[model samples]
Target: TTLLRQIAGFDFPDSGRITIGGESVERVPVEKRRIGMVFQNYALFPNMSVADNVAFGLSVRGEAKAVIATEVQRALDLVQLGKLGGRRPHQLSGGQRQRVALARAIVTKPRVLLLDEPLGALDKALRVDMQIELKRIQREIGITTIFVTHDQEEALTMSDRIGILRDGRLVQEGPPEEIYNRPKSEFAATFLGDANIFRGDSTGDGIRLADGTAIAAGVGAKLAAGAKASCAVRPERIRIARDAGTPDGNANMLKGQVSKRIFAGSNSTYFVERAGQTLKVIVQNTGMERLAEGQDVVLRWSPESTVLIAAN
Candidate 1:
């Protein structure tokens, strides 16, 4: 919140600079920043009606009553709450309250919109629904939005580009797919999703895990032989079978015994133990028979699917 408050002008930056819309906003007041912020808690006034809440920003600026009414109704309609204008925060559902908060932020037509875990308060189902709804509203308004969330899936699903922050510093920034598939570091690879890491010496061709298993990886530059390096593979990219059975020549292969299996509704995750390491593989549930725990399995994946990085 402190970071966001600084950008919103509630607090001053101690160093560096703050700019918005091609102009420095370090000296701009909060009310003049034209930055709309929706807090994690939705921060809707419980005593105010939905219409009043949506119109609050414009009203505070002394906008005419007719203009406030028009903008408030338009914002409410955009959030699909056109008929709930008279409802109070306490009387609305969690998703409805979220929409109300969003309406309030956007009703003033700010140049930039900041959302702090906007859907964090909703239940799983409602949160998913709001993700879609929020994206829809954002597109309709075409406003530049900065969304902050600890939920990896939400960031992936709702962002055009993502910046991963670690210890107040940006570790990586790129399109979601690029960041997920070609993470520059172990923290980025594992933090964004599930990654099975192979850590050992780089063999100039690929990575040789601690067990002496050399896994081929397609890397931009070959690492010097005997250099400490690591490679990561996403769980879903690996294919598991009873045997190698003439796997692709360019693919890396490993044999292991299934140590455990997690049965999610849409998918199944298997933890395979091979040479003192556990490799994770996720497969979609096609209503087919799945390998049981303790079953021997062969894992194969193309070299291109593996990401190589320094062992740091």
Candidate 2:
């Protein structure tokens, strides 16, 4: 929120430059900066109609009435709320109200759009639907958007490039796939998604588990020999079976007992105990037999699925 505020000119930075469209806006006022922002709370005027709310920006700037009417309808249509222009904020559904907030933000055709957890107030289904809608509208308008959210799934779903920040510093920035699959640090690995982290001494190629098992990690293995390192394996990449089947030369294997099981609609999660560490494994339910709690199982995954990271 502080960072967004700085860019919006609501707050000034202690030291540094804020550039929008390759131009510095250090001395620019909020309205003149040509930035549009939508808050988590929607921040709509309670007594105004939807069209009035959408036209507020252009109206404040003294735009001609005819121009404001045309732009307001266009913005409302862009958000699929064209028919609800006469309704007040209180008369609309949560999703409709959100659309009103978005329409209002984009009505003035700002150069940059800043969304601070705009969908945080919606229900899960509505939020998911809005994620797709938001992406569609963004691509159609081709506006540079900066979205801030603590929900990991939301970040992954709506981003083209993701920047993971910790304590006001950027920990990592890359395409979503790269950040999720090839994290550079333990914080980045665990923050973006669920990861089964193995901590041990590095062997240049991979890390040796505490139980003397060699786990191979071909990606991001930059640590020197005998140094403290860790490898992260996403739960979905692991395959769990009751049989200690033939070991493949290219795969890492572990023997453990299922300590717990959770049944989600489309998948199942198994907590396996091995070497004093509980590893999480997610398996999709594809008509396959399910493993029971307390059952001995063998876990296998490809070396390519493992991500090597420096221990914090």
Give the poorly placed runs of model 2, Cα more than 4 Å off. Answer: none
Q: Show the colliding residue pairs in model 2.
A: none
Q: What lDDT does candidate 1 reach at residue 7?
A: 81
Tens digits of per-residue lDDT, candidate 1, 193-277, equal 9999888898887889777788888853367989998999999999999888884889999999999999999999999999888
> What does candidate 2's lDDT look like per residue over 37-132, in tens digits?
999999999999999999999999999999999999999999999998999999999999888999998888899999999999999999999999
TM-score, candidate 1, is 0.96
Give the local distance difference test score of model 1. Answer: 0.90
User: lDDT of each structure?
Assistant: 0.90, 0.93
Which 10 residues in a row give candidate 2 its minimum summed lDDT?
243-252
Candidate 1 local lDDT, residue 255? 94
| Model 2: residue 224 alpha-carbon error in angstroms | 1.5
- Cα displacement (Å) at residue 42, model 2: 0.4
Q: Pick the candidate with the highest lDDT.
A: 2
